[model samples]
Target: MENKELLKRIYLLVKPHRRRLVIAVVGMVMVAGLTAGQAYMVKPLMDRIFFDQEQALLNILPWAIVLIFLVKGLFYYLYRYMLESAGQRVIRELRKSIFQHIHTQPTSFFHKTTTGELISRIISDVTLIHVAISRALIGLLKDLVQIIALLGVVFYLDWQMALIVFILLPVAFTPIVNFAKKFRKYSVSNQQTVALISNNVHETIAGQRVVKAFGMERYEAKRFSDLSDRLYHIIARDIRLNSLQHPLMEFLGGLAIAAIIWYGGHQVLSGQSTPGTFFAFLAALMMVYEPVKNIGGMNITIQQGLAAAIRVFNLLDTKPEIKDQPGAIILPPFRKAIKFRDVSFSYNQANPTLRNINLTVVAGEVLAIVGPSGGGKTTLVNLIPRFFEVSAGKILLDDHDISEVTQTSLRDQIAIVEQQTILFNDTVKNNIAYGDLDRSEDEIVTVAKAAHAYDFIQELPEGFDTEIGEGGARLSGGQRQRISIARALLKNAPILILDEATSSLDTESEQEVQKALANLMKNRTTLVIAHRLSTIQNADRILVIQEGRIVEEGTHANLLADGNVYRELYNMQFKNSNSEPSNLTP
Candidate 1:
């Protein structure tokens, strides 16, 4: 986007606080007027008190200086405080908007985007804009006003000297413009490098176990250090560009001052101007340089802010791929079977994940899907929740299309326990209660007991209140999986989806978890994606999928009798199990 459009959008954010902004603008005007008033007093103070020996003016000149400064300081504080407060409010809203927008995105959006990149945009980028709004933008307005006020005084005292300074001023800005372009380029590179560093830190910390097991500490450290070094170089180049502005501006300012001094002194000696007028013009001329220099500094901040704004706006403008259709009705409770008629899905459209599949999952029935690694078993179940809309055809729940119903209501009827257990860094009680926030403590404990998680949870330091570290790092794999089962049990949904829930557990843990799963799946319409054939032998029906197509379907005994795809899978797993010595206790 163009800078003008970007600034306009930022200005709209400030519109809600227009009253405070108006007050700040008024305070800036007062500060400018007072600054000019101070320089204007230099003439009467020098000519009347020191040169003319006017005792009347001397009596109150010092008092006048104090009063002028006191008022200027008061308004300076008022405006800065107001602007900063308004800036903070804007940042708060922007953070919330970005966070809420991220939640609206489909699963595909997250699959393509990294966590650290989103974090940098929401936190780091917004902070730079805060500096621009609260300090740079506000400072620009104040300095511009002060420059104009000071210039007016200089012209009134001596027009010839004022014109000389004005002509030299443009020379300083030429270098500032060039530096600003370079500052923007470096600033953008710096933000991107910071995001890469953040992504590295996130990955290393989350996978510290893998890193240590493989003895890659030195390797990871070198990788992180390389990213850090790149960031340092980018910032150093930016600093060099920013530092160049001051000295060059100072040189041009010095030249203007020298010219004024030579020409004005000659006028005084020639009796064309008094010492009072010459010195007052010189004072205002020097004051003008301060605001001009401030404006030059603000240019760097503005450019950096603009770069940050581009990223933030891009995220905000992103449209979510999956959203509720207009006039969509809330889904009622499940009373009939779910039907997938001619359903097909593809992530990239180049390779279809599921092809022309048809199936019916009756209420209160357990239908297990056995498939090879990439046969789209998980993808088929994900479609039920509308995580990714089907590329073609439709899914119907009791004759009503799933997509026609609201997402929240549809998800409310389903519960899931996956291969990799997901738990937050929160108390055990809260994790279980996440499925149903309004679930009573008694209900939570009952479900935990049913899932066989109550024993280990009670052994924790704080029982149910114990804090589980990130992703339940403090808990054993079996313990975490049971907690996940407990969460699903608490939801008490009519539909359940289990994606290899017991596949990752040891013999002892699997038996315990299987008992919990039996209780949880009592009357629900359950869909099972099994990696181990033995676990799903008791399922009411089994479908053997291969290459995104159902190659066989029947009971375990019937499929074995048929001696087809299901029988092959059963024989393969049965042989593998027999090869390994049994760990089961008699």
Candidate 2:
């Protein structure tokens, strides 16, 4: 977010429409030329009225004034319309690039950021930058033309009056520059504070269920209020600073005009300057002052736009923590096995979540990972598709390093059914077909039946076309899980991950889901993360994990016989269930 970097990004934004911008600039110059004619016309008209025969020129005078206005109005519309259109197109393209870049960012970015703040950048800040660029560019061009043309008129009428303009320029500019510098700092602070406030509100509303369950509503409200107050204070401060320049410059402009009139009157009465000539010089001075004032205001707008540009550029400049390697090849279909060689990972580098560990699964085997909460079970499965980069070691897919292959190909070969149901607001068939975009109706139905979702789907009002609410809120937890399973089934990837997929279901629902999962795992390489020991009791091999590393690994029966960690865990769940009375006591 350095100054040079900001300018570079702004340049890139305008580069695509350079030809259009040039045309717009030419239009703006024509507009300025027509506008400058008004100042030039005042001198000739004033001289003809006073010195020449007034009646002879009277009829033509009104016509000339009318023509000047006509030309000015035409050029004004052309310049404003063309330049504004160019700015809108450039901003549209910039916003699209930002959205696409965000999509390409690693999944971890979402975990660390809020959607609301990102949305504000894409919408509000972008619009501000667009307005600033378009208006500032056109205004600067017009001002430059006006300054040149008006200064020529002033010097022609009286060189002494032109000196007053030179003196007034710096007096008007110094305060504006100082105000703009302060406004820039405040504007950036205001944006950051507002982003924080927006994030607080979004997170609170999204997690309202937990807030209510824990009776932490007051705490969340207070947190939101504090951030909101900070935003308010910063914005008010920026407004106060921005408001100062306009009035102070207006006062200064008035003082300069007063000084010019005082000095020019003495010259006119002394016969050193004609009354007509003095009026002509004063008209040019008035014309020049408007651009100077506008330039002063435009400086602040430019600074505000630059502040927003810095934030946008910061996002664009960020490097993803996970990305494909240069010259990486796509992974071919799995035929042999998958291996993790001394893998370790962490959300934060200071604390390790997964330790150095080695595990292998044959092409068509089900390897279950059993662990306590936060034992890295979900984290381990996430690594299979490069959702995160391994911190210490490499993971290989059929002897090729996963990092050496493109993410799209690696992910396309794997499917995941998460514990929480994540369905979009779409028809039942669309949700199931989400895993495979090109899947036909038959393929979708076949996969749904295999995942035990077909019966419930048919019973719904619209059957396969029934609209599910956001996140499948219309469906029961078990039904949502089945839909997720159906999605994985339709994918038909060589590798599958079931992360506590059925752990949240009731006993009867779990039994049915386990059957569906078992059938789906028949000929595919599956990685299971189980919280309920019973769900994975029939896995090909079980790895008992504690903290970050594997503590034990064996078959279910063999581990039970060993009477170690797995045996202890199995007995605990079993004893808890058996401890319940068979009949209720009176």
Candidate 3:
């Protein structure tokens, strides 16, 4: 994005709080005026009170100086408060907008990005922009106004001295601008390293069980240490560049002060200028450098903020690959069947995962899909919910192309229960009600009872209100799967997809969850991906897929009679189960 365009976008974020910004700017103006007034008072104090022995002016002048500072302090606090308040509001809105945009992105986008990286951008990068708005931009404007006001005082006292100071001022900006560029380059590097460290920490903590089991603690520690060390070096370089600005500004400021003291003092002693006038000029000149130095520092901050903004805007600019077409109609509830007409899909164009597939699933029929790992079973089902777009061909629901309907309406008619149960760190009630948030307490209990989850749930101390730990770590695998079933059961959609829902459980748990799955799948058009062939023996039909192609399709008895791939799979599973001692009833 262009600089102007970036600035305009930032301005829009602040535009909502423009009234508060205006009030803050008014306070800044008052502060600048008071700062100039303090310098202006120096002349009367020196010449009238000290030199001329004006005793009456003495009592009033001291009080006036105190009063001026008291008012300036008040306005200073007000403006800082106002700007910071506005800055916080802007940060809140920006973070929300970025988060909402992230949700709009396709699943493919997440495959290419890490959760840690996105979290870092939302937290760290947005903070940089916050500082830029609340500190850098406000400081730049306030300092500029103060410098201008102080310069007026200097020129009024003596234009010749003011002209000399102005001439050398532009030279000081050269090093400041160059240093700012270097600071920004280092800042970007620092943020990237921080993001890597975040990713490492997130992965380490999330997979800590694996780390402990594999005894890779030392290796993970060393990896994190290396990333932390890299970050330290980048930050040190940024600090070196940042520290250089202050002393460099002081050197240039010292030179300007030295010139003013020499030439202005000479004029005073030679009777060409009054002592009071020369002192006032010196005071104003000294005050002017403070704001100038601040402005120089703000330039570096602005650069850092701009770099961060570029990253944030780049993410926001990404258009989601899957969105409803313009004028798309809302799909009504499923009635007849789902048809995939010559469907093909590929994550990358070089390789296809599903190829020229034509399949129809009639309403209320349980269609079992049996396949080897990586045979596109999951990919085929995911396309129904528009999790990914098909590379070629189209899917239709009762003759209406699914792409011609709103995704929300299409997904509303379907519910999914996957192998890995996903439950948030919330109450059991909330997790179950997620399927249909409008469900009442009684309705939630009904579904829980239907999924066989109510027995253990009531055994908990808090019953429905118990807080489940992250991903339901507090619950056993069987309990979690039952809760997942309860969630799906509550949706009561016309279509259901069960992807190896009982694969990870033991015999006892599988038997328990299989009952819950039966309750959830009742009267729904169900698609089952069976990990164990025994679970789907009663399915209306079973399709065997291998290497992205349907190799066989028939009833379990028919497939067994044919002695094809399905029969071989059935025999292998049957032999394996028979060889092992089993507690589960046949």
Root-mean-square deviation per candidate = 2.3, 3.8, 2.1
Which ten contiguous residues of candidate 3 have the minimum total lDDT? 577-586
- In candidate 1, what are the lDDT values of residues 216-295, reduced to their tens digit? 99999999999999999999898887788888899899999999999999999999998889889888888888989998
C-alpha lDDT score of every prediction, in listed order? 0.88, 0.83, 0.88
How accurate locally is residue 197 in candidate 2, as Cα lDDT from 0 to 100?
74
lDDT minimum window of 10 residues, candidate 2 = 577-586
- Quote model 2's TM-score: 0.92
Per-prediction TM-score, please? Answer: 0.96, 0.92, 0.96
Residues 1-586, candidate 3: write the lDDT tens digits: 7889989988988999998899899999999999999999999988898899899999899899999999999999989899999999999999999999999998899998898889988999999999988899988999989999999999898999999999988988899888877877887888888889999999899789899999999999999999999999998887787788889889999999999899988999999988899889889988998999998889878888988988898888889998999999999879999999999999998999999889999998888999788898999999998889999999999888989999899999988887779999999999999956789998899888877788899998899999998888789887898888788888889999888876766776676666666665667899999868878877888989887778888887799899488988877778756544331123
For candidate 3, give the lDDT of residue 425: 91
